[model samples]
Target chain A: MATMTQSGKPADAIGLAPAAPIELDGITHNYGSRLALDKLSFRVREAEIFGLLGPNGSGKTTLFRILSTLMIPTGGAARIQGFDAGREPNRVRQRIGIVFQSRSVDVKLTAAENLKHQGHLYGLRGAHLQQRIAEVLERVGLLDRADDRVESLSGGQQRRVELAKGLIHAPSVLLLDEPSTGLDPGARRDLWQYLRTLRDQQGVTVLVTTHLMEEAEHCDRVAILSKGKLVALGSPAELKAKIGGDVVTFEAAGPEQAAQLAAEIRNRFGAAGTVLGSTVRVERDRGHRFLTEVVEAFPRRVESVSVARPSLEDVFIDCTGHRFWTEDAQPDPAGGKNKRGEY
Target chain B: MATVAAAAPQAKTASSPGIWTPAYSLWLREIVRFYRQKARVAGVIATPLLFWIVLGSGFAYSFHSSSGSGSYLAYFFPGSVVMIVLFTAIFSMMSLISDRNEGFLLSVLAAPVNRSAIVLGKVLGGATLAAIQGVIFLAFAPLVGDHPGAGAVLLSILAIVLISFELTALGFAIAWPMDSPQAFHAIVNLLLLPLWMLSGALFPADRASGWLAWLMRLNPLSYGVDALRNALFPAEHTLFPLDVNLGITAAFCVLVFAASWAIVNRRTHKPAA
Candidate 1:
């Protein structure tokens, strides 16, 4: 039996310089006629918490499926640590821990039992397996409930056990989909805290997919996807910083009034102003000064005005020409035919 | 620090715990999961007993074959044992569908284990469960007045194991691509149960009219049913010779198992298709 030996340990595991944990080179996929991912390219550096951000039809789920070795890509390649994910899936699977968006733990089995079975799948056994199970349970703060059935545990606790099951193998890269889906705010925070700890302490690379912008904020870097294309990719702060200056919006009484005010602001201040329904939005460098200048210029034409820093949501809107969430344009490209993970 | 560094690489990647480890683990899981579900255990025992009593006794007084050595109840004994094996096998394979729906199958698929290990684990587990139930129903043989001695019992047990393996493999084949338990049941009732019915279990193959007799002769399950009959009634060599029946049953096990393995080890992981 060929077993993993000690020589393969990277320098990063010993707190040395990190290696590129994951690299996706022009990964493309199609669900029949719908192209889920379009020439997607990105690289996640070592010990980094990376997020794949998208909406229901934006293809994050498809990308997650490919990277987790659940689905092979229609085109291009995904490599985990140096091994190709599609071609050498078993080797990729050995180095990665996957936490699916949906519940994967056996509710009927005890926490210890679930971990035991998972350990066996990874070829861990005997007293060594038991010790690893205990360690992972303790790390998840569920050692006390090790013997209890998963059905007896709370939703948050069950999610933690799912994490424990993944961590039992202690792979270098952890991929999760919608990790905060069922978790309450407190549990969500705890989950992020654990992810950060794993990155800092164990140098484990974390890659996650999320639809929520706030959730993406916790990641070290985010790849904003829209309609199967990489719209934006950078740290949350850097992406926000890249948008530049501030966003100023003026709420007028009506669309006509807002349009009239936008025209005046465009001519007077030479700031690009667009009427967005009943509000006129302007992007400027010195937003506060521009807000006062615009308000004084318009007088009673502007009912109220506000200026704020750019958010990840603003970056998403700026890149995609839409809000983070849209009510009318429900572009479910898969046609809800596949029930696995749309949103 | 050197020792920790040496151990750190082990954490980076998983080891292969020999060829059979994953199969053993999955097999153990099936057994553990089966024992934990009290309803499944009750269902396993009660359904066979009920079928044997209700169906066996219903035909006991009414059924008068033109030529037979014993009562209909005795005639139905071996068939009832095969029924027990079938029901347990059905129950075991049904979990495969449920497992796929509930996300456990996804986890297993992502594991570093080989696909053949998965097939071996699940098939062997279901076969073991069905075999146990079949043997338990064998204890009721004395009540039906067909209690053969030690050699007969040993041969009958072999036939039961062969039949159990073949049926469980057949169940795995049926349940492989199915997504829903309802669909699996519908197909089993429509196709699988009919296979057993025409297998000379309910009625003798020799008595069937022309084409129907040929169908019984062709049905692989008939070989299993006929093998059991030969072992139970060593004196009555009607369907086929004992050695011939056992050989065919063994061959049936391999055929169905190969069919199952082919389906499971097929490349893509699309469960619905």
Candidate 2:
């Protein structure tokens, strides 16, 4: 596991022999006047399925581009297998395979043809290239459909072809940007299963960026970002454990009603509860007992109340002081500009 | 299926991709993609053929050439060939905009390939297609009653290759910085269409007035059109000798290709997409 110090420096060099597979040492990026990444730093160990969880404008897309060597940062550095991404992009490109959020495969070509082209780009040639193409197609469980044109494949199968194209070069690190954007439920499950197989069997380190909490739950470790800063970094269970208590919610008719109830509860019990829209949430130990006393104290004022264990979303709220999907965080339909108003 | 014993990828000294492999692969992709679209092939060839017939006959009676070529169709034959080359070369480079929009170019940009190879592959691919289309138009030389010897035919083919290379490079330079096809179409119509119309393709430079004649002389494509005229109609009077015309066209090809290479290699603060 990788650790971070209080000063936001990676503690991986504390008697470790080999460097981590992917490391961001104070990687900062600015799109014009807007700062997209604010001195973010972390380390990803080898063969681990790491996730970058953030909403739009959290700078994960900018960081993804930097890691894939598509964009250079304004400040700091991203290193892949110890090669700086900005200075020696070709070196970084050779060690990493990138699966973009958009479709990158040539739809006119068949699956095998796409892989062959990708193989040639990485210096593979002749009979060896053909064998590797077949091997990768088989690894993605698409060998039978290798001859079919990508235009004819279903969306899930086309995504698998993209995975095969990335794997044909045998890169040590696989970087995926929103790998499950349009996948169906079953296909999404299958995609995660294949990722686990790749990590456990081939020892390929995978770094994925996603906004879905359920997707982040499937990762071995996740780094959560909000407003271009690292808020929490750990396994799902470990980060959820940091909440230290159960979460209790009181739902009212409207924001005004919820605000009134939140003020009364804070005054009477000397507890702090956050009012978000039409709900007031409080985190406390023995949440069931606290729930009963609060409901009894203000009958019908709290229209509904519930107590549950702390989830990853609660950890996000605890760190960021806001919900994961705020009203203003909706993605722009015009493209290029993210939720943070950065292009 | 349960085996988890795959060998780890060994770390080797990273080698930047040389020109040949990536260029060849990209070039091969262009060829495959072009052949797959049957309507594109038909339209690229047929549209120019239609214009050659309609415009050649439409202007035949109303105009008489100062060059003493018997009919307007013969005078317009090489011009139509040039038109075919122009349309194919410029239109083929439009794929670059689509490639970028569809995210295919992003994959290529992320690969360990050289930037110059990208320009080379794409330009050469379009040039090859354009040259082939121009030659296919050349096969109709007999219909215009212009019969040249084997040497002249070979020279005409060489002129078409140079013309296609230069035009495709020019189009590549224009298309690299643009994102939308609509903007590219606007630039093509405003800039390139006039360059072709004044290149002695439709009218001989000697017959034109002072300023239009000067414009023809200043255009690099004028030299190419003159070279084709010299090759296809050996007996007809030409503006310049064959050697001088080809030399200028070749120089333009190198210059435009270098401009495209520089554009691709430029490191900007903005995203490459």
Candidate achieving the largest TM-score: 2
DockQ top scorer? 1
Worst 10 residues of 1 chain B by lDDT: B4-13
User: lDDT per residue, candidate 1, B1-273, as tens digits?
Assistant: 676555443345467655488889788888988999999999988987898888878987877655546678777888888888998899899988878777788888888888878888999999999999899888888887776889988998999999989998899999978777888989998988998899888889888899999999999888888888888877654678888889999998899889988987776623221
Which residue pairs show collisions in model 2? none
lDDT of 2 at B232: 92
lDDT by residue for model 2 (A152-253), tens: 999889989888888878888999989997899999998899899989998899999998999999999999998789999999999988877899999998
Docking class of 2: acceptable
Q: State the C-alpha lDDT per candidate.
A: 0.83, 0.87
TM-score of chain A of each: 0.90, 0.90
Ten residues in sequence with the least summed lDDT for candidate 1 chain A: A1-10
lDDT of 1 by residue, A1-343 (tens): 0112366534545534333578888999887676778999889988999999988778887788788887788899887875677877788888889898777888989999999999999999999999999999999899999999999999999999989988888888999989998999999999999999999999899999998989999999999998889999999999988868999989999999988888888788787776668888777888999888887877899888899998888888778766667724436543344443322
* Residue A248 local lDDT, model 1: 90
